[model samples]
Target chain A: MNYPNGQKKQINQQNKSVKTNNNIFSNRGMSLEEDINTTNTYYLETDIAIIHKKPTPVQIVKVNYPRRSAAMITEGYFKQASTTDYNGLYRHRYIDFEAKETKNKTLFPLANIHDHQIRHMEKIVKHGGISFIIIRFAAYDETYFIPAEKLFPHWHDKLNGGRKSISYEKIKEEGHIIPFHYQARVNYIKIIDRLYFH
Target chain B: MNYPNGQKKQINQQNKSVKTNNNIFSNRGMSLEEDINTTNTYYLETDIAIIHKKPTPVQIVKVNYPRRSAAMITEGYFKQASTTDYNGLYRHRYIDFEAKETKNKTLFPLANIHDHQIRHMEKIVKHGGISFIIIRFAAYDETYFIPAEKLFPHWHDKLNGGRKSISYEKIKEEGHIIPFHYQARVNYIKIIDRLYFH
Candidate 1:
């Protein structure tokens, strides 16, 4: 079926299952971002939550006003984000967080996060928002929801000349494992529902 | 005087007064956006609120990575926003809003708002977020805070064979007039506090 904009129905496979394709399907299925987008779409459709990954910020240096229609940016540069990439209102509360995927199976490096992002998360926390980080170990096919509260201590330790990364064991111990759901792939909100709201 | 970024101590005049240079200072003052940003900064500094204007969204088509320190976006376009430009956490409540300025003094044409923005505001209201529009009549030097609850009705009316523009009288009657403070220029949050929190 073709729509006006060639819009196709999104294949939101909540459950990790497909026909005649086990390992091959699982490996090529979805990225961490795709999973979260699918999950956010489900939450929005069901009136459970409303969250969105903000559009990538761009600084346009030049634009052309081609007669009729919207203006076109001819020259631009991607600006370093001063805050996290995702934020929204959930259950009448502000929810803000960042997501990262690393192939390393042993640890999630602190270098994955920037100093300004840490400051932004801290501000969110201080202002009574639910803040967290979603760290996915792509090598192990595991994802963890590490709350800002759990991760801040490790971040603060850097000032005291500490380890620059959180060991995988530490993440598993401190963070809640987000299980994949049939209707909501990479259901981090399930962990949030259990940890924060409960 | 020059403290790195021309930083100066903000004088948050809650009652909107300072000295003899009333009209003079007001004429040579900051824009609505600058006021909001400075206000957000003050709020962050004083631990009052944590809101930010999401960076402008740009769609990058091509990038030149010439083994340099940064990549330059060679082809890009400014994308229309699917959601409001500013959002944040305020007193544990999710707050989101869009700002617009018009030189017209009478009616605010519905053309200024897109269909997607109306839909986005509807979702925010449904999801229990405080959503609003800051309509500044630059000609009249007046700013009004129109809540989603009120604006959505007018938006829906347009779809139901109603007027495509909202008259100035109607807006002033329904919307709360936002007073311009010295530091917090467009103090729409004051109206938010009264309507949502109070």
Candidate 2:
């Protein structure tokens, strides 16, 4: 409930929408990004870890400065990010990851990720950082944490004219289910603890 | 010279300005941010590190989506960053730092850095991540890598109504001068090697 300025507005909007829809289980209606952001905030407040969702990239073309008000961007376009969505320090380890949720129950499409992002994740892993992807099957209400190393083979296969998506069965076999908590909604760090720390 | 899209445009603008000013020492003309970015690109290309400068944060207030056109931000405001400007993996460690340049030769003023950034750096150090500030004395043509630990005392002093700035002589004694090079222009990793890896 103690979200920061910009995030507070977003949570309030979501709450309003949930009320309008009369959704009894409002917690389950949160998007993956919102859940992760809340989880990161909880980790930051408790001094457990420091992770953040990088701001959406924007290419500003024009701005106007009023007499006293803050400079306003009058013209800008969204830019495709060259790196993953989230990254920060966790348990003295450099952590980086991308989160994607799909309505399709059968597969997670590779088109959701860019080639540069795949290469970035590759470099992160090679440099001894913890890298992964959080895949949410919205239809099943399940989120999986798949390590970067586990993902590379599938990405390579796609590049070599193989299946362009990872099957749900394959993901379930290779990935760890991220537990949902009241505070740390998408508790991916718990998976990291089991995989790397312990 | 292999700068990315937005950065290439900026470098071109800087080059044009330098030419107009007839500043012969063009290498020294680059801003602290540009130098660090170039150095980071070099490190990434050479597979030495995976550090990156986070994109400038912006808060979007309005957007226009014309048919068959990319969505444009019609109204936006710059947002204060919650963390340091630069952060990523370096030598299997979490690297986070802020870069600042001052024209004053006598001392580096404390006002250039925000209080929250100081707190963020403090937390980074506590979590065993590598945290520091890259300070450029534009008047002296020197860039120094001041460890977060070394900076805490001065920041605390400012909080306690002590000197509002750290003098140039004190910085010379406590901070390591980041060597300038053709590829790794700022060459901050050299200082990290000497201080941490050695």
TM-score of every candidate relative to the true structure:
0.86, 0.88
CAPRI category for model 1: medium
> What tens-digit string does per-residue lDDT give for candidate 1 at A111-148?
99999999999989987899999999998778899999
**Candidate 2 local Cα displacement, residue B119, angstroms:** 0.9
Clashing pairs in 1: none
Per-candidate iRMS values, in order, are 1.5, 0.7
Winning model by DockQ: 2
> Could you give me the TM-score of model 1 versus the true structure?
0.86
Tens digit of lDDT per residue, candidate 1, span B83-172? Answer: 888899888889999888877889999988999888888988887889999888887778899998999889889999999999999999
Candidate that would win on lDDT: 2
What stretches of model 1 exceed 4 Å from their correct place?
A1-20, A23-29, A68-70, B1-24, B27-30
| Highest TM-score model number | 2
Residue B8 of model 1 has an lDDT of 27
Alpha-carbon deviation at A79 in model 2, angstroms: 0.6
lDDT of 1 at A64: 87
Error of 1 at A22 (Å): 3.2
